[model samples]
Target: MIKVAFVFGFRNENWLGGINYYRNLISAIKSLPDRKIDPVILIGTRGSEDLLRDFPQLEVVKTTLLDRRHPSWFFRKLLYRISGRDIVFEKFLIKNGVSVLSHHHPLGKRARVPVMGWIPDFQHKHLPELFSEIELKSRDKWYGEIASQCSRIIVSSDHARKDLEKYFQVEARRISVLKFVVDYPKDLDLLDRAALEEKFSFEGGYFHLPNQFWQHKNHEIVVDALKILKDKGQKVVVLATGNTVDYRKKDHFNWLCKKIEEAGVADGFRILGVVSYGDLVSLMVHSAAVINPSRFEGWSTTVEEAKTLDKPVILSRIEVHQEQAPKNALYFDPKNASELADCISKALLCDTRGKGGGFPLNDLAVSNNFAQRIAFANEFQEAVLAAAYPQEKVHSPML
Candidate 1:
């Protein structure tokens, strides 16, 4: 079997996009035809254990290097460079028969194994103001080195693939646009909308903004739009849920709250901080519509989740969001609060009368979308197999 190790070493921060992306990926890969490939997740001791609880059936390997900030990280990084691989990590992989390493960061140049590096987006280049000078330099250097070193790079959207080629001069063929796939349970319809609303203390007719409070996510614009609505004597309630911290601007969330209070629209906007996966989905299922007003995205998990559930979404007209083209999405300019205010007002009006939310669930559409995702995953697996054993034809049948 072709054994590919997926390393999960994300920092325990407010953002859940990285975790959600890999979770869906693991789920989709597991559903592929049996005996084609074996996937293993390598994680650290600290922040990763709780995140992977949903994946109890997955094969997990715990290690220290997964924590980049660990006390011994310096020594381990030096060891990797000295020998092209960490001795302990190499041994663990060999004992488990691992052939390839797929991680969010670039692997050491000395390692003989083929790596699939993931660069989610070039947001720092696009929105430089959101990052400090040190972070800007780090992002440029890290992405450039990874593009030059990795056997192949994985991006979430074709827009990202184009950006990689244009800015980093990475070859188009070297990049794979593996758009994310949402893997919802078959019994999603069985969820009681009323119970979900009651559990979250949310009314049935509130717009949902289920995005982290990252600066670039443009939460401020949503609040500004609510101010516009309030001025016009239109009271629209927006329920926002996500991590309430922004590492770049530590006080960004506090600033947003202050703005809401100053605008005298605190009652119109609700901030529901970090919630469980079940509660998050419950909020979505019962909301009037989901909204994403981000200035940039590689591929939005919010849009994917809305599409899977056949719910309405109001998204900012960024290039990547436009590329995603969610089925039931309405677009608006991110900078214009009036445009978004118009969108929210209209969506709520349409949603209140059961016009947009009454569409019958189409199981075939969901299954077809999922099949396309599995096919893409299979193509990626084929590439990994070719790198591991170039002499053999490892192309498996389509799903």
Candidate 2:
């Protein structure tokens, strides 16, 4: 079996999306029929045991090398500077017989094993005002290194691939577009929707806005939409849940709170911040519809989750969202509050829930989801193989 290693070090709650991304991707890898690729996670000593438990089927190696606070990481950095190669880490991977490293930062040009660098999006390029000059330069430099040094680059969407080529001038031949598919929990049907709604204090039908309180998420538009609904005597309620902390914009959540207060739509919005994953999924599954007002996205995990459940999504009409093209979806201009308000008003009339408060999938839809999961795994395996054996002619998946 071809062994592929993924570094797991994101422990911060603010990066819950990143954590879930790896979890879903690894789960997809494990679902491959042939099982030709062996997925391994090289986690730090401080890595979450909960995360480790999520990957019971794969090999997990705990090492000090991945821990940022550990001295060995500093030594690895020094070694990279001195010899123009991550010699210590390279030797460690070689010792472990890792054929390729995926979804991590670039090692060095002189490293032995093949590296597949993943750039989720060009958020900094598109929203430069949100980042400091140092951060901008750092991201640009790092992306440049990934494009130049890595054997293959993995991007989430065709939109990101275009951005990578347009800005970094990376050749299309070396880039792979691997659209990830979500694997929902089996117990979704078991969740008591009424109990969850009562626990979360939902009075009636509510729209779910699960995007984090980041500036680019464009939460203000949603607040504006809520205000419009309230003024029209509409008893609409929106339940927002996500990490309230944005390290770049420290006061963003506070500002959103202030905006809600000023707009006089506080009664219409329930900002339940940083909820458990189970609760998040429960909220999504029980809501009238899921909403994503983000001005930009790589490939929205929220959108994917809604699609997996076959739930209706009222999304911002961004390029990537169009590319995602969920079957049961409504599109609106990201900047237009009235348009979103109209969509919300329309969605309130639809009954998406079934018995037990879940949107039950039909047999054909279930089969299609399984097929898509297999396709995701196959495309990911092909990318790994291409990175490991560039000489072989492996057809790149369609953008």
Candidate 3:
């Protein structure tokens, strides 16, 4: 089996999407019929034990070199700066028998193992106003290095692949598009939707907006849409769940609250900040429809989750969202509140409660999920093989 190492350096709750991506990817690989790849997680001493518990099936190697707070991490950085080589990290991967490193920062050109660098999106390039000058420079530098140094580069969407080609001038052959898939729990039927609704103190059908409170997420449009609905004497409840804070925009959450209050739709807009994974899934399953009003995305996890559950989605008309092409999605301009309000109105008329009422798992749903997992694993494995064996021509089905 080809052992591929996934680096887990994120410790903050705000990066729940990142954590879920790795978990779902590993689970997909393990589900393959032949199972030619063995996925391992490389975490730090400061990493969450909960994260370790989430991946009990995989081998986890904890090392001080990954922990930013540890002195060894600083020493490694100094050594890299002095010699332009990541000797400690390279040695760690070699000792652990890692054939390829995926989805981590590029380890310079001189690294021993094959590295597959992942650039989720070019959000900084498109939404430059949301980022500071320092962040813009850092992303450009990092992405540029990944394009030039890494043996293979993985982008989440073709939209991102275009961005990489346009902005970084990288050859199309060097980039691989691997759209990640969601792996829902098998025991979803055990989650009591009614009890969760009672716990959160909400009534009947509601729309779910589960994106983080980042400025680029464009939550102001949702607030405005709620006000438009209220003006028409229609009360629509939107249950928003995510981390309330955006480190880049410290006051973004408060600003959104103020906007909701000013629009007099505070009664209809409920912010349930940072819910547990099970509760989040239950809420999505039980909602009238899932909504993603983001102005930009690499590949939307919310859209994928809603699709896997056969739930309808009301999404913004972004290029990536169009590429995703969910089954029952209503697209609206992210900047137009009236358009989103119309989409929400139409979504409210559809009755999706039955899908989540008892969480029944039909044969069709199981088959579709199995097929999606296999496709994701096959594409990811192809990317790994291409990176590991650069001389051999590995044809990706995605390309």
Q: Estimated TM-score per prediction?
A: 0.91, 0.95, 0.96
Give residue 243's lDDT in candidate 3 (0 to 100): 87
Off by over 4 Å in 3: 188-190, 352-360, 394-399
Ranking by lDDT: 3, 2, 1
Residue runs of model 1 more than 4 Å from their true location after superposition: 11-13, 67-74, 81-88, 185-191, 354-362, 390-394
* TM-score of candidate 2 to 2 decimals: 0.95
Order by TM-score, highest first = 3, 2, 1
Report the backbone clash tally of model 2. 0
Candidate 1 per-residue lDDT over residues 1-399, each given as its tens digit:
778998887657456888888877777777787547778988776645777755526788877666677866667777778776566565667777888877545556655567788899899888999899999999998998789888778888888888899999997767777887877644334336666556656554688899999889999888899999999998888889899888898999889999999988888789888877766776776677899999999899989888877788999999988888878788999999999999998888778653234332477866776786687667667667765665676677786
Residue 285 miss distance in model 3 (angstroms): 1.0
lDDT of 1 at 276: 74
Candidate 1 — which pairs collide?
none
Query: Would you list the clashing residue pairs of candidate 3?
Result: none
Q: Per-residue lDDT tens digits of candidate 2, residues 1-399?
A: 889999887676677778778888988888778767889989888887675444436788988988885899899888889988888999999999999999877788768988999999999988899999999999999999999999989999999999999998999989989898887655444346777766887666788899889999999999999889888998778889999998998999999999999999888888999877778887887788899999999999999988887888999999999999999899999999999999998788775332213654567767877889889988998989888888997653432
Better of 1 and 3 by TM-score: 3
User: Global CA lDDT of candidate 3, please?
Assistant: 0.86
Q: What TM-score does structure 1 among the candidates reach?
A: 0.91
Model 3: ten consecutive residues of lowest lDDT: 352-361
